[model samples]
Target: MAKVNYPEEFAGFAITDTKDWNKPKYITYKPKTFGENDIDIEIECCGLCGSDIMTAKGGDHGWGSITLPQVVGHEIIGKVVKIGSKVTLHKLGDRVGLGAQAFACLNCNRCHNGNEQYCANGVTTYDGKYPDGYISQGGYASHVRAHEYMCFPIPEKLQSIHAASLCCAGLTVFSPLKRYIPKNLPNNEIPKVAIVGLGGLGHLAVQFCKALGADAYVFSRTDSKKAQSFELGAKGFIATGIDGWEKEYFDQFDLILNCAIGLSGLNIDAFLSILKVEGRFCSVGLPAADEKYNVSPFTFFGNGSCLCSSALGSREEAVELFNLAAENNIVPWVETIPISEEGCETALTRAWDGDVRYRFVFTEFDKAFGTGSA
Candidate 1:
């Protein structure tokens, strides 16, 4: 790739130091070189994700090391401001969203095989290295640049704020549910699908499971989310804190998607026991580093269940997720904060502390950074 001209400046809410996240500073940055297949989106709203908080807190998040002065928000909903000459997938003025991925070498086997999330040269939305030596920045800004293939056009029925969370949190669970959950099971005997934890990802998982025509059940530690879970179309709610909860639901689930973030106090064995023979269990949440799940060979072999992990889904899967959301009227429960230096900081801090009801979306980018290229 050839070096391209760098823009004079672009404004974004950024944290200069990894250790100090008291507040983000509104500052200008030199954006990555524009590519022919890239589209520059003027952000409307960006959702606060757990990964963003984890990155800001400073640690190596499996994929790579954290970089300083990072603009961190990947669940982005925006309007297309500029499109590269060769970009034909989307046009200027299109409403779209970019998820955890920003770019992937399309020539790679993974990219060509409809598994772009596993691309060897995958570039994340933030904390990533670009081909032109520019560090990949994220959507907590006035504008964001991403390959056309990574951008999915938001459906008209889906509002920008609501579409924001689907970019990452929704896709993280939706992809695995689509891949693992049984589709042809009878209505009476439809496989029971359990969502572990009722946080951002799990809450949306419940809605998606119902939309996909499965029996959606929430497995939470407390009964706090029981009423809300049922209201969100869940078939039932299982509070693990209740005595003999595991025994009550033993061997009941055909597929279990664990959306819980940490494994420090998780009863992995109890979760595994709920799955019937040949059941599938997949985790999409970013657990703490060094938090291990230990399973005995007998426990593993006797149940004949499969365990795995999922990351963000492909761009095509993202489009399908948005379509499903629109068709089913599925909207995430989000608290909106105006997009400003202080607003960004507040959202991040609350999200870090796990205080948000479900998700937080930062809006009003035009007022925050002005209505220009930046």
Candidate 2:
């Protein structure tokens, strides 16, 4: 007897890190079968997050041992082919997007309060935990399987390639921007926001902050991204090395989103010096879990400030972000790559070296979208 092939059980990339890029052979994966609760996505694209590099190595930064040879991606955008029997949140053939944390224990306090990403124990789409001890996979391949709650419908106006970075980088920054906006300042005054990195997450933060009505600023170690910053809606750009830059914007930011993955040589005092009194400095850039940092003890006491961090976002937030992007026409700046291209290793290398313009979104739409082997 032959078991029927469910639509969600599409063949896709099964990646297994071969350790040596010179002899590159990746194990692309295909689900053995599909379940009713599973939704299959035609993985149109996936972004290259900094976390992906740290995760692939499985080192001391503190995510513990990553599932080697595992498909590595989470910033994903795609189209759906099927939904489960019990699923009511989504339907067949929806343009949807998914992010880092996939599912959570709904009974937990955080999950119940619309912060499922903070659920004490939850399943991340990749390099994370689940009930069955099965290591979750990611969107690096041609297709992906996820629960209905973890997905958001894509805005009709969004370009799928650009929408890919919005999942992780977009959501990570989105949660903080929404929280930092002053409640009484009227909708128009979204505040002056500064983003500390012009990489994968920082670029998206620029677009998001601009879309939210904030005066956006970009801070980079070098002035290389000034042109891109303007194109992405940044109202201002600051090169970190300018001798008097600190004095100019001191106390100017109501909110500062730090997207710096590593804090080495980071002028913590200098970065904090720009915040207004009672301002919040929120960080979304994480270096695995073992990375360490020193908070400015005196700055907090004197400036009346606090520091915080966020873990992705909730299912409801996903819906809101989806509609927001749709309504306002926010566009993410990204570089596209075909999933079957031989240069994937090269792209991963460049991403590791921090050479990618903003992000690398793997277009897994090959074969399925009138393209072949790619």
Candidate 3:
């Protein structure tokens, strides 16, 4: 909790216009009077997620009209330098992090039950408006002022650079694994897990599943990521583009996590065929514009299985995720960039081109003169 009053103005990134969703012009934000439940953090790092790009150009959000000229960062890790009068869960100088969520309708049953992400009227940390119409910026700039209710203290055991990316991407996979997988399977049957795609979320999924004792496997269109996947402790790798490969691992995995993007030509029949009886197929991939699949009913019924979907997990689950990562020594494969990179068009163009090894992060903030990077 920061005791002193904050500067009337602070530095942050804002997308004030809906131009190219990728190349957002940087802007500054001056915060309101320090609220009793709000704490200000000096950001250390933020991971560039796929949604940041989507929000910039706009997408089929269940809600109407995508908010633009909105700062588009969410995966944030930083240290609290100020605390509100009523905040006790965290204190001043404590290392902490915030995810895609900024505020939620706590009065709703979802928030009351700890599933804040599902709240219908939730305010995203970036490019969203609270019920009061305050547009929430993200971690692309130097400092973040958010309600303490939406933040968590990252444990000291984890390093800040690594900790920055996990608040969201790390939590994205951890949530479902804890919720979907059996609570306590025997060591031998820890559940054979297969991760599709090897990007930001996919890579973390591999680490989370591997550290959780699953015989983790990686599936890519090609074998290019084979060595890196194994280095992350993957037990096996398969290239789906190769012919006659599906027969080798048919009915093998207990849980198949699809992390790849775009659904065109997706071999639904093939991927499902690899699942054991009563196995599950889950997805976190955001398909390209107007993407769809052609799956027959047999895909689920034939295997005595079903499909499940999840967003990021609860606040409690996020903490548990950090604990698990610390205990298991799991770390994400990441590439850091200065916030000056101009996120929307330039940053996202590179991302879409597969220019990033795994994840791209933004760092270094300056308050007086907008973002130091751009």
Alpha-carbon lDDT, every model:
0.85, 0.73, 0.75
TM accuracy, model 1 = 0.94
Clashes of each: 0, 9, 14
Order of candidate numbers by lDDT, starting with the best: 1, 3, 2
Stretches of candidate 2 exceeding 4 Å from the true structure: 1-25, 28-36, 60-63, 186-190, 288-290, 368-374
Per-candidate TM-scores read: 0.94, 0.88, 0.89
Question: Candidate 1 residues 158-251, lDDT tens each?
Answer: 9999999999999999999988888676556877899999889999999999888788999889999899999889999888886667887788
lDDT per residue (tens digit) for residues 151-213 in model 2: 888777888887778888888888888878566664555588889888888887887787777
Give per-model CA RMSD: 3.6, 3.8, 4.0
Best by TM-score: 1
- Between candidates 1 and 2, the one scoring higher on TM-score is 1
Per-residue lDDT of candidate 3, residues 1-374 (tens digit): 11112355555566554455556665656654467888887777788888776666565421224665566778888778788899888888788989988777678999999898898987777766666666777777667788786787787888776787788888888888767665465565668888888888888888888767677799998989999998888889998897767789888888888888766756877888898888888887776556667677888776876676678878889888888888888887777676663533566778867788788877554432333232
- What ranking emerges by TM-score with the best candidate at the front? 1, 3, 2
lDDT of 2 at 303: 74
